[model samples]
Target: MDLEKPARPPAAAPAGEGCLVVAVRVPVRIVVLVLVVPVRMAWDALVVAGRSLNDTLLRPLGRALPWVGRAVFVWPFAGLWRYVLVPSGKGLAWLGKVLVVLPAVALHRHVLTPLGRGAVWVYARVLTPVGHVLAAIGAGVRTGALWLGRCLVVVPSAWLYRWVLAPVGRAAVRCAKGLARLVETVVAGIGTGLYRGARILLVLPALAVWHRVLAPVGRVLAVVAREVGDALGHAWRVAGYVSIAVGRRLGTLLRRVFVEPARWVHRSVLTPVGHVVRDAVLRPLGDAARAVGRATRQALAAARASVRRARADLRRTLLGGQTGAERKPQLTHRREPNGPRTRTLDGSTTALTKD
Candidate 1:
């Protein structure tokens, strides 16, 4: 495998560039560079200022904003929800369940359920049978009405349509077809004439203007616009390069003038001074403070002991009774009585028998 990357081929220049484009490009680029440099520099300055503002102000404010919002907005509401509103809501829910829901459930179960059952029973038993009877009567009446209508209206209308209306309708349809044919022929001729007139009067002239005049002007304008655009882009890139060089020089100057000296002083002078202070002053002061604390604690303990003893003696003298420290603890358990020792076969005492 090759370790080095392959070099890319150079881009081919465009083939059809005219002298107009070349002529436009040079002057446009020069003008654009002059115009864009100041804008690019200002843009870079704004970018630096924005970053400094974000670092110095906005970032700290952003971090603190959440805590401030929580303190001002979230925490009080949370406290109200946790300490006040939650309990109140629970109480209200319980009250509503007891006063409203329970009674509604009971009413539904005891009264409404029975009433609905009775209504269902009535519908099933009485109203259903009555509706069926009424529906049967209505169906019989409908059958009679249909029979009367068929005899009185339907048969006559069928005969009239078949014998009287059909022949006249056929004659009228034939006349209409001839009239439509004539109208279509006339319309076709008129439409052809109009189409020819519109083409000669409007379309030809518009086509000539578009091809002869507008197109050439548009092409020239497009070429100029394209050159301008290319020039702007090229100039902008050059400005960016210039900006980067200026920024680097300024950064080097600032670093050499200020930052290096400050760093040197911090490293050489402040660090050793801080170390000396810590070792010579702070460490000794800390040691002395620890010693004093120990002495103070010991003295306080001794004083506390002396005060306790004095209090105990004064209590005993005034009350005429022993203090708790003077009292002895009584034995809680008694020793068992020993019996006479029993002799074994070798004339030695056994442990359980001796006791």
Candidate 2:
């Protein structure tokens, strides 16, 4: 065997080094072309092609055209590129910058603008409807904000008055004194009226008239009480009868719910179906199962016997020819031997000879 070392793999390039080299070279090549032969050749080719095309096409047109017409045809395009297009492109960039600052300027102007003048102009315009909707929404928001601010300011002051500055006991005492004075004045007036009425009333005889009127009312009330009691007693008897009837009906209904029927429905609709399932389906299936079991057992027994015969045949084949050493005595001889016998290959039999 040749004892030689294996070759090693090449090392990997460093990251970004390959890309940086390519980027540097590509720009340098482009600069060289732009600054040297390619730029000169391109400029020369463009001038030559332009001159050739102008000579071939425009020379004929110029010959046929008036000078003023040609000048008019060229001047607008020339002016458009030099003035409008170039300036507009630059202005567009400037406009982009302006847009960045537009929101701040808009906010300042909107805030500083007089609301009254703006609203008058807004209402005069056809956009007044939209303006009104926006103004309404804005006013609603302003009102809500003012309300919220007022609540924020007032809630603390109210809490402070209630908790820190309120004189609860003094107010309660003043209220109680006022209420007591009002009550005492009313009671003194009533006492004065009674004092005046007592002297007049004894002379007037109003008490005797009240007594007579109350005696008649008492007799009438006794008669009304007896009538009402009798009516209520009759009502109670009717209610008791109704309750008994309802209770009997409810008991009968409950018994119907809880008790079995007086007579059962003989020969139910499912009886035939149950009989058919048991007799037709289940009986046939049971017979089939028994037959399958018997056949499977018989097949198993036959297979076992076949396996035993195959095993015997395999043993005989493996043992080769059945020599005396290989033969089983019980299988080889049908009866018992006399003493000992030997069989020769030539078919001669010899008896045992003792020494």
Which lDDT values do the candidates have, in the order given? 0.94, 0.80
Listed per model in order, the count of residue pairs whose N, CA or C atoms clash below 3 Å is 0, 0
Q: What RMSD, rounded to one decimal, does every model reach?
A: 21.8, 46.6
Q: In lDDT terms, how accurate is model 1?
A: 0.94
Model 2 / residue 346 / CA error / Å:
44
Worst 10 residues of 1 by lDDT: 333-342
Q: What is the lDDT of residue 149 in candidate 1?
A: 100
Regions of model 2 farther than 4 Å from truth? 1-263, 266-269, 300-355
| Candidate 1 stretches greater than 4 Å from native | 1-151, 301-355
Q: Tens-digit lDDT track for model 1 on 241-326?
A: 99999999999999999999999999999999999999999999999999999999999999999999999999999997888799
For residues 1-355, could you state the per-residue lDDT of candidate 2 as single tens digits? 8799888898666676786787798899988977899778998999999999899998887887876765787788889989999999889978976886686667667864667577778778857788789999999999999999889988889888888667876788899999999999999999999978985788356667658787789889999999999999999999999999999999998767754343222245457767889999999999999999999999999999898777777877897666443578575643334457664444344344311
> Looking at candidate 1, what is the lDDT of residue 11?
51
Q: Ten consecutive residues with minimal summed lDDT in candidate 2?
A: 260-269
Name the lDDT value of residue 284 in candidate 1: 100
